[model samples]
Target: MTNVVIVGAGPTGLTLACGLARQGVAVRVLERATAHADGSRGKTLNPRSLEIFADLGLAGELAAVGRTHLPFRKYFEGVFVNETEPFAGARRSATIPYPASRWLQQPQLEALLRERLAALGVTVELGADLVDVRQDADGAEAVLADGRRIAAGYLVGCDGGRSTVRKLLGIPFVGEGDPEPVMVCGDVEVEGLDPGAWHQWFGPQGAFMLCPFEGSPRWQLQASPETAADGTMVPPSLESFQRLADTHTGREDIRLGNATWLSTWRVNVRMAERYREGRVLLAGDCAHVHPTAGGLGMNTGIQDSWNLAWKLGHVVRGLAGPALLDTYQEERLPIAAWTLDVTSAGMAAVVKGIDTPGIGVEVGGVGDFTGLSLGYRWSSLAAGTPAGGDPGALLRAGDRAPDGPCPGPDGAPGRLFERFAGDDFTLLVLGAGTRPDLAGLPGHVRPVRVEDRDGEVRRAYGVTGEALVLVRPDNHIALVTPATEPGPVHAYLARLGATG
Candidate 1:
């Protein structure tokens, strides 16, 4: 029997397999496609998402191949309205190890993840689409397209929006489609222009976005034509793609060459009513799908994998209770909802030619929306979170703390995220006065103090005001109280099956 059977070999499934395999858990990822998924769906990596990859030891590779999308621009009717770079303070505040946000192609990003999983000896079965699934108290079983049966301690569906596992499990995905789907995406080589920077053209012709792909001057184009309804139904042919480009840019001489991958898809803003059922769980597109405006789809899926991987591994290893898995849905579902909201609003603003939506901010790191700086508010562990205020406050016990750099007890420069290296629990202490005596806590719980030697790390966590923030192995905040006694800390761990 396998420890975990993941249905889908996209970034989410591959990432989960990589994380679990690093923790010595046997993971099998099944994909319906005959080979790795190579598409041009999402092209940008939010700063926080890049930090997650850094913890997985792929930051160097990601940084090497990925392009930093500087000078973000907004155009109105083919006219430039405003342009700005990434948050400046974010680059300066890195007591953490990774940069804020960078842009990389989806194919390269997925390839790197698959390579890491392979290096760890995790095998992904391509073309083995999940046809049927069933779960019991002991384990879950999946039927592949070839009529093969695989049993595992748990099964997670990371397949795309049309998820067979999700359908077989009878989970209702509650959401709606974009009434005006104004996004068309495909990868093509431009013959006459240097694809070194990101360019956007807006106006009566709608909006066109082009970004440079790695190792070539070729560009990936995403746009909405004024004549086309919702950027959907454009034929996936070279002639069709060039025609759309011509209509948007009004350049008849532009030839779209090297038509490697092409597809026209509609954007949906939907998520599952619930993310898990018994021994079965959901991640990636299976759990939620949002507009591709903010490039949040793939990143959110990767985050879901990060959230579920550690607990699943621990439960399978008999180190944590099955109840620990409940936190996955509780913690991630909110993010999916919030991301959808942000993307929906932003897309509406962009389409209407609005220069500054509430989501846009200056370069000083005031409003970051990669879901990296977001905190948890609605969990049993986060009982003290302020009610009804802006939910994006500092990290609480049940929220994932933003990662930055910190000095270890050994005085070595360490990242707050490095604690999640290969998956382990972390306890973040704010004030020296409130550092609970953790001598009696479980050995796996890593206690960290953000008391002195910095202001950004201190302010970023809001621990000075709130006291202590307990972070889970998956990086979700587990608790937040104003310098409480050790009782709540001990109680929190016990509830999650942590033993001293």
Candidate 2:
């Protein structure tokens, strides 16, 4: 029996496998596709995801393949709007360390994750699709398409929206809010059009967006009508694309290269009622499906894996209680829901040109929609906050912490996060009050003083005013206290099966 068996080898599955395997957990990933997908569907990594990659020691590698400030270059009716600014000042004063976000294509991101998993001796079984699943108290069994059975302590479904594992488990994805139905998505190389900017023509002709790809900085066009379509478009020959480009952008003389791939589909904002049932759990699109408005699908899914991987590691290794696993749903469900709402709203707002009041009009420098700063407030793990009540005070236990580089112990500065970047449980104390008490907790527990930068840790946790904060293994804040006391801290640890 493997320690874990994951279905799907996209970013979420590959990330989870690498995270678990690094901790010496045996993981097997089953992918239905013959090889990794080469689609350019998802193209942005929110700040939180960049931090998770940093923690996994792949930050430098990820940075190498990614370009910055893609989100900054957004548009409205063929005009430039706002672009993200350099996070220099804030990063210089951060408590936790890392970049806010990096822009990388989906195919490149998946390829890197797969490479990381390979380095850890965890290779995925391509062409191995999950035909059925059976779960009991002892373990969960996965029957593949070829009639092969594999047993594991736990099973996670990171498959796309139409998840076979979710279906086999009989989990119903309840919500569906898809108002704008028409979509025109394709990856093509076009000449004469500006490759530096992402343009959107929002007038009556319909909405169209163009994002630049990594190679040659060519643009990938994504357009939509008021209605959704289920038809596929043949890859346009260079001549054909140029003709279409002329019609859309009004550059008749423009030369368009052959499209790599072209297809169209509607976007939806929906999610599963629950993230888990019995020993089976879901992550990424399987658990929730959000609109591509902010390109949150891949980023959120990567964050989901980051949250669940650590808990699974602990539970499988007998380091944390099974209850710790429950926090995964409690914490991530709200984030997923919020993401769906925001993205759905953003898409709707764009389609109808509804002005979001008091939320600012631009996207960079104080006006941007910082997808990385999300925090959780409602869960047994996070005590007392509006979202989770007093029980959710731990920042947003089981949630992702936004990135900000901080000073290191050495005279030279480093990230406030470097201490906990080793894939272990981290305890962040914003003040000196609880550092000494939380110290000497355990080998897995590392405590850091959040003094160099005020509001740095707070911002990362999405806590407006809180002194002491405890983050979970997955980088989510677990507790927040006006004062640091050992009792609640110990209780939190004990709940995770941590011992004195």
Candidate 3:
């Protein structure tokens, strides 16, 4: 039996498989689709997700294939209105290395994740549709469409909105749906349009957007259809898309052809009441489905898998108690609900032709879209703020551990993130003194001493002379305390059952 069975071979499931397999846990992925998908469904990878990819060593690869900077150009009936750069003026800082979101198609992102998983000696099993799932104390068994049963210690549903695993577990997906103003989205090859900027057109008919896909001739097309009295949507077709383009842009000269994929989307905002039911759990679209305005759907799911993978790794390896798994739902459910509201507001603005920027207008600034501000400060695992430090400091016990340049043991230049690349907790000691007594440290904890020559790391962490910051395997700060008082560190670990 495998250690974990992941249903649906999307970005979320594939990421979980890679994270678990990297830590020597056996993972089996089931996909209902016979082959990989195409088209640019979710194209934007926010800054937080980019940081996670950097930890996975795929940041450089994704950056090479993605477009990092694209301005949004608005047009009124084929007449230029105003242009705005959503990611403009964004610069990388010592703490935040990736400050900009990336534009890469979902298919490409999933392919990269699958490649990484294959390197770890795991492959996604295609054409294995999950029909039902049953769980007991020992383990959970998944029944496939072919009447084959597979047992695993845990099951995660990363399947899309129509999730069989979630349904089999009887999880309630409660939310509201918008009946009017349905959107037709797809990828198509077009002529008479410059591939320089993301083109948006507003007219009496409705608003339509054509964003150039990175490294491809095809562009992602999105258009809001006219309201139907009976709330019926026209099936996606090449002719229908062309008609939309002509009607919205008032330009018949622009030709649309070679449609690769097409689908109609409505604003269906929802969240699963519970992320986990016994040994079966939900992640990604299975747990939460929101509007596509903020482009947070896939990015949020990627983060969900990242957060759960380390906890599952520890529990499966016997380094932590099974109760640690409960924190996944506790920490992620609220974020999902928040994202749904933010995206729903953005969608409302879109319907009103407000030309809202990426990440929503109600949120403070563009940084909010990067997801850097997202943290689990209220989580039960995060503990102990720094002593004598300002309460308003950017770095906190539950915030993301910032990255900075640091010196390695051999005096070579290295990064703080290198310590967190693996499946182990990293303890950073910022001071010039000798390393503290780590004899009581658990085997899963890796301690590194930083000299803090120029105090760049110190400034980023808001620390004074000497401090110890315990970073979890997911790169979130777990504990912050003065070097003199290391008892809280041990106590925090004990709460999570990290100490053996």
Candidate 3: residue pairs that collide: none
Query: Residue 130, candidate 3: how far off, in angstroms?
Result: 0.6
* Candidate 1 lDDT: 0.72
**Model 1 misplaced regions, further than 4 Å:** 72-90, 94-99, 178-183, 225-234, 354-368, 383-395, 403-405, 428-437, 448-460, 463-469, 480-484
RMSD of 3: 2.3
Cα lDDT of all candidates, in order? 0.72, 0.69, 0.85
Residue-level lDDT of model 1, residues 1-500, one tens digit each, is: 99899998888888889889988998898888898656666777876677778879997899798666555554554445666666445553554444556777787888898889889987678789778998898999998879899999889898889899889989998988855545566777886544554666655655566667767655777766334467455555667667766665566565778776665557688889899899999999999887666667788898888878888888887778888788788888988888878777766655555333222222212234566567556665465552222346644545556667666778787777776565777767665455566777788787777654555666766544435566776666666555556567777778778776
lDDT of 3 by residue, 384-469 (tens): 56545567776788788889988787999889988779899998888888366667888999888989878898888888878888
> Which has the higher lDDT value, candidate number 1 or candidate number 2?
1
Question: What TM-score would candidate 3 get against the native?
Answer: 0.95
lDDT of 2 by residue, 165-278 (tens): 998888888786555445666677666666655555444455555677655544676664322155544333444445445554565555656576566566676789899997
What local lDDT score does residue 116 receive in model 1, on the 0 to 100 scale? 94
Model 2 lDDT vs. the true structure?
Answer: 0.69
Which is the leading candidate under lDDT?
Answer: 3
